[model samples]
Target: MTEVLLEAQSLKKHFPVTAGFILARTVSSIKAVDGVSFIIRQGETLSLVGESGCGKTTTAKMILLLEDPTMGSILFRGKDLQRLTPAEMKEYRASVQAVFQDPWSSLNPRLRVGSIIGEPLVVNRALPSKAIQEQVRELLLQVGLRPDHDDLYPHEFSGGQRQRIAIARALSLKPALIVLDEPVSALDVSIRAQIMNLLKDLQHQYGLGYLLIAHNLATVRYMSHRVAVMYLGKIVETAQTKQLFSHPQHPYTRALISAALRSRPDTQDEEIVLPGEVPSPLDPPPGCSFHPRCSNALPLCSKTTPVPREQERGHWVACHLAETLTVATRATISAEERP
Candidate 1:
């Protein structure tokens, strides 16, 4: 079995909504990330997929320790992060890194590529200036950029190259885990594949674990070892990539897959158009938060919270009717149309 690099157990983060500007009182709380849990194993890519504002990024933030969780715990190799000393926390910081959605904003415009990539080393004061430069050059080369291009500023490079530079910086720390927050979404479709391939190659070479937050199903399908689908600040489904793609048990998961398949002109699968807007996190609907948008929602779904069940081997679903839905869905689909 693969070693677990990082684990988030029932992690929760709630942002207070203040009514008044000065001497404000707490009106309500936005449940940004409510009880999300998962683990990333060595060299594995675990993807968190959901619609915008579904708390995927919030979950990543908690994992990176950028925002303190309102409740629950984060463990790095079975060691609780909250218990770490200052020095140990600093070390932990070095062990985990992140690459954000926009490379243009993430990379420093004024700095040369080499300066940007080597900044981590410079800040940590881990290596001499000459060694840092050498390391930057090697990292650039590893990410498929020419080592000599390090002198160029962010503006001089194309979007794809800028993203590669960002990636190189994240790699500079030799991190065990990387939280990639929509890393390839801002790039051109053509460049997205290249970046995805590079990430996979890097993971294989370094035995790095990745917590990928992405909306692109094709990219998720190609990159992820395991996948967790989120709905209204909660994880609704989780399974191995093959299992989830082949047989999604939750209504939301099936809908997402249907939509993804519809995007391909080649596939003729009927699109599952979910009705109703996502409920506000500040005032989420009772019971299953996704009940308002769920097609197979039962009366009980609205009154009782569903527990995640292992409906199949390693495939978990949080829904009142997952088993019934799975059986009905399978009975309707011909083997030829299944993706």
Candidate 2:
């Protein structure tokens, strides 16, 4: 059995809205991540897929210890992160790292590529300056950058090259887990595949666990071992990548899959356009958060929030009508495709 590297239980991050003059009191809160739970196994990549404003980034931030959780806990290697003190938290930072979305914004324009990659090592005081330089050179080579390019600044490299430097910097800490927050979203289409392949190789070489957060299902499909689909601020479905793609249970999952399939001509032509806007987190509707936009929503969907239940082996879904609704949807699609 694969060992669990990171486990987040009922993690919630709610930013309070205070409205007053000098003495401010909390009025309401914006629930960015609400009760999200998942496990990342050692040497496995778990991709979190969701639309924009779905709290995926916030969840990643919490896992990386960048933001404190308002409720619940994050356990790394069976140790509760919230229970740790400032000194321990600083130590924990060495074991966990992050790769942000924009490469241009992530790297310092004034710093050379070598210093940027070696900065973490220097800050952590993990190695001597000579050893750090050698490590930086090796990391650059590992990420497909030439050793001679290390002296150049951020502007000297292309967008993809800058991202490679960002990745190299993340790996410098020798982290056990890395939260990849849309690492390739800013790269060109042609360079994206190369970067993805590099990431896969690095994971294999280092046995690194990843929490890959992205909105692109296709990219997630290629990179992830397990996939979690999120809507609003909650996870609606989670399963092995192959199983999720083959048998999506939640309505939101089905819609996302339908959209992904539509983008590929060889898959299918039908597109499932989810109607209605996503409700505001500040004023979310009662009951199921996705019920307002779900096509097959029933009366119970608006009355009670469905807890995530395992309908199949290693497959969990949070929907009142997952079983019946999924079957009906498959049948409808099959009938439409028949000659």
Candidate 3:
């Protein structure tokens, strides 16, 4: 069995709304990440997939310790992050890194690529000036960029090149875990594949664990070892990539897969369009938050929130009808397989 590198137990992040000028009375809160829990095994990639505003980004931020959790705990290698002191937190920062969505916005426009990548070493005072330059050059080459290209500014590089520079910088400290928040979403489709391949190669080479937060199911399918599907502010389903794709028990997961299947021009499948827009987090639906949009919703689904339960080996789903759905799905697959 693989050792767990990072574990989140009911991790929650809520943003408070304030009203009034002088008193600043607190209004309702927006529960961005409400009770999310998962474990990332060492050298494995866990992809969190969902629609926009579904708390994927919020969860990523919490893992990076950028956004403090409103409730619950984050344990990295059995050490609770909230217990770290100011200086210890600084050291912790060096062990975790992030690659944001937009390469253009993340990179410093004025600084040369070498300086940007070397900044982490300078901040930690880890190496001499000459060594910093050498390390930066080596990192650039590792990410498939020419070592000499390090002297060029961000504007001189293309979008893919800029993202490579960003990735090289993130790897400068040799972090154990990386939180990739839609790392390839902003790039061109052609360029996306190259970055994905690079990420895969890097993970194999370094034994790095990753928390990949993205809305693209296709991309998630290609890169993830395991996948967690989120809706509103909660995780609705989680399973190994092949298991989730083959037998998605949750209604939301089924819809997402249907959508992905429909995207292919050769597919003659019907799309599963959910009714109504996502409800506001501040005023989430009572009982099951997803009941309003779920196609197979029942009376109990609206009156009682379903907790995640194991439906099969290593597969967990949060839904009142998951067992029934699993049987129905198997019957359907059996029918399709008939000659």
Whole-model lDDT, candidate 3? 0.90
RMSD values for the candidates in order, in angstroms, are 2.2, 2.0, 1.4
lDDT at residue 117 of model 1 (Cα atoms): 94
TM-score (C-alpha) between model 1 and the true structure: 0.96
lDDT of 2 at 295: 77
lDDT, candidate 2, 1-339, per-residue tens:
878999999999999999998999999999889999999998999999988888999999888767889999999888898788888788789988998889989899999888999999999976889999999999999999998888899999898988999999999988989899998888999999999999999999989999999988889999999999988889999999999998889988888888775464576655789897788899887889998888788899899999999989889999999888868877998998999
Candidate number achieving the greatest lDDT relative to the actual structure: 1
Candidate lDDT (C-alpha), each: 0.91, 0.90, 0.90
Cα lDDT of model 3 by residue, 1-339, tens digit = 878888999999999999999999888899999999999998999999998899999998888877889999988788888887888788778878999999989998989888999999999866789999999989999999999998889999888988899999999999888888999999999999999999999999999999998888889989999999998899999999999998788998988888775465786765788888888988889888999998888899988989999988879999999999889978988999999
Q: For model 1, where is the 10-residue window of minimal lDDT? A: 261-270
Steric clash pairs (candidate 3): none
TM-score of every model versus the real structure: 0.96, 0.95, 0.96
- Estimate the TM-score for candidate 2: 0.95
Regions more than 4 Å wrong, model 3: 85-87, 261-263
- Residue pairs in candidate 1 whose N, alpha carbon or C atoms collide under 3 angstroms: none
